[model samples]
Target: MIRKSRVVLLVLAAVAAGVLLTAGFNVSPIARALLGDKEKPALIPAAAGLRMVPVDIPQLFKEVSPAVVNISTTQLMKFNHPQMRNPFGRQDPFDEFFNNFFGRMPKEQKRRSLGSGFIVSPDGYILTNNHVVEKADEVTVTLLDKEEFKAKVVGTDPKIDIALIKIETKKKLAYVALGDSDKLEVGEWVVAIGNPFGLGHTVTAGIVGAKGRIIGSGPYDDFIQTDASINPGNSGGPLFNLKGDVVGINTAIIQGGQGIGFATPIQLAKSVLDQLKDKGKVTRGWLGVYIQALTPETAESLGISGRRGALVSDVTSGGPAEKAGIRSGDVIVRFNGKEIGDEHELPQAVASTKPGKTVEVRLLRGGKETTVAVTIAEMGGELGKPAGGHDLSKNLGLTVQEITPEIAQRFDIENTKGVIVSGVEDGSPAEDAGFNVGDIIRQIDRRPVSNIAEFTKSAAKFKAGKTTLFLVERGEARILLTVKNK
Candidate 1:
């Protein structure tokens, strides 16, 4: 009987709250005027008898909503492709029919996602997320007063996922000031205003969850994480400080989780924005080498304890690194003016540099620290493909077989198809053909050859002085390729 009474009292309390919230409660005269005397009732601010100098969200909204414009984009996508697939995992048969009639041409997919952005300049420059305007054939920006205008993408950086766009509003547009995102403390209050889940201009409140979080969005993943209930369609919106300055750009989230969301710190976005506003594209420095992060064993080999810095795995001939005297097995400790902490940091540092600018690169080679001056080149522009590598077994001679479960069942061998060196006698061609123990011959003359008879037939088909393509399936997808006198 006591439990029943408590439940009834709780229900009564909830009903009273609903009535008080919707009973024209906590509304100022100006709010009533703007809303045309229409009763929203649910818009009752939490504190009816609020403190004199409390956080005035509605006033903040009035100033912010003008700069917080809605962005909608459309792009052409290949019909039946991943981008054009229906949200429910079904495609309209009509869509496929249109594709067949139009050849391989892409179908127009109106991926209408709503996001929030803010104007940065009086000249109609706007900043948003790369995901908002990237690959967009058309973008439309709607202002607070319901004024809609067409927008053009100025530039975009996929690495940081920030984009710059422009529109000719023809009037002095409202804008926001950029605050130092690096100065934000973990417990500082931040507000997120966005079109989350298609509910336009929704506001959520939370504090900075953490800083310098690496969510693996890109090579440079130092994001400012927050707990402000951001959902889909909030990408590219501004995360604001209580002072109403744009501090961060809301970027990503972990799905099916609570109290976990992330935003790109505005400091990085400012760099990208400045570049895009001045130049149509960003130019980055290029190094002609592939690098691998060092493992503990590799760190020991490199004479380092913690295995820091990037280890050069390969050098491109005539490339910037090679020409600058950079070589494989060297660890890059610094680039330009910044100290490289690890392999991942190197890319971001290089990408920030201007093309054609000669920069100092520090490296450790042969246990000796050295510095080399490398002239930066424009990244990814007209670079030719490198030649294929050499194979020793093919240069002399080799024969092997692919060890398989079925073959293992037949040949009574312990392992999979390894090249079985056949006919290796004293001073014989097989002996000359670099044959080794348990070598599996998976290919001959560019074709796969299994078993002794198949190997013999394939070897006979190859003419001397001609290159034979041998697809030797070695252990675990490893290929033992050889080129030798046919």
Candidate 2:
């Protein structure tokens, strides 16, 4: 009986102790989730080895936004009929209504494309693309500080797709300095600040995907390709290096692709800007040669190990190359001491060179390397003889002309050759006959017509709706043609 009474006393004491312990501390949900009915204390979180500090992108925007200018163009275009126009492009019903009501409507289309530009000089000089201001009737410059000024087009080079402009403002405009684009490495961090989608001061971050990408934008296409999100209004904005210098001019992008964009290297822009500011016009060197890319078949035929370098299809008579003894079938391997990688690279190297400067041209002839010095001549000047004109133009859009003694000697054509038609009109009768320019006419209708008069008589028969046979000479080769008048 005493033992039972003692057990009851102990059980009551245990219950009281349990109640006191439960009152002292409650189990956290986190601890209860892991330990279930057995309540336990939660453990304190330990600090990680390293923590990434949050970056202040707004600081970058504030630093570079002052140097970037918002370029808005106003062009006077005469629109005839449509009341509400959709110039921005094909959009749905809402886009059409937005343009019709809010945007430039049925009135004369003073169509203008809004883009971005950056001041490269403290003196108010700016750099942009040629397409941005090419046909701009009036260009208005607006700053990030809400100031506007009229800008003048200083100089433009459409070939390289760069332009220089000056704004008449003495308000101490903020400008970005040009960086050395030649020293930029792939995967370097780049920031593009521009007004994209008409949104004000949009800045995007990316890395340079590649350098010297040929996007077929122009003759000189050594553009820096980036995965930067360049869009509609980012055309002329400054692509900044991490040092806050302008490394490139944000120019183009792949429309449907994400993050594929291109820019004009600041190095090329600097040279063009200097020339544009001083000379008002760009004078490019002329090599006077029609070149084509070497294909695999051409490489096999030439017994070349690799299909590279520009192939001289035709050399202009009395041009800089011809003056230096450069001839047809010669492959230009090097120009001005730089190796020619392909056909397009040759043009850029040649055109960028100064006129009247002698350049070393290394060419491959008969599997032998030949060296020649060519003094570049001015382009677009009228010479005494018709340089590109062939009698091909006169005879129904087919330019054909007698190969002069000089041309025959230059191109290595036989002196006793008939007038050659160099090009034929597409869908024209000559195209059906498979007649191309550079085909030397040797005989007509099986009758030997050496001179122009005899050739004219045979050609006249074809004019009266008759088929005429022609024996054409094509580079130490001959081809027969039976073309009937259509």
Which candidate leads in TM-score?
Answer: 2
Can you give the TM-score per candidate against the true fold?
Answer: 0.62, 0.65
Write one digit per residue (lDDT tens) for candidate 1, span 1-486: 999999999999998886556445765644554455443211233455441222455677777767887888877665454434566878867678766776555455456667778888777888888888877888998887788899989888887888899999668999888999989999777888887876677788778989988887886788998988788888888898777888899989998989899999998887667777788666667777666565554454446566668877546557888889886567898899788777777877787788889999999876788999999887775443221111223434553444557756754545343345433345534454344444456545434454556666666665666434343322222232334354
lDDT of each residue in 1-486, candidate 2, tens digit only: 999999999999998876556455664433343344332222222256232221334566787788898888888887553344357654457656766676754556687788899988788998888888889999988889878889999999887778888998657778887899999999877789998877778888778899999898876789998877899999989898766789999999886988899999998888777789998778888888767676654454444557668977556668887789886557899999899989878987888899899989998776778899999987774422212223332333455667778768877764455777667788776677677777777666556656566666666666635555555666644455556565
- The parts of candidate 2 lying over 4 Å away from their true place are 1-57, 79-107, 381-486
Per-model CA lDDT versus the true structure: 0.70, 0.74
Cα RMSD (angstroms) for every candidate in the order listed: 16.4, 17.1
Off by over 4 Å in 1: 1-60, 76-110, 381-486
Candidate 1 has its poorest 10 consecutive residues by lDDT at: 384-393
Error of 1 at 274 (Å): 3.4
Give me the overall lDDT of model 2. Answer: 0.74
Candidate 2, residue 56: lDDT: 32
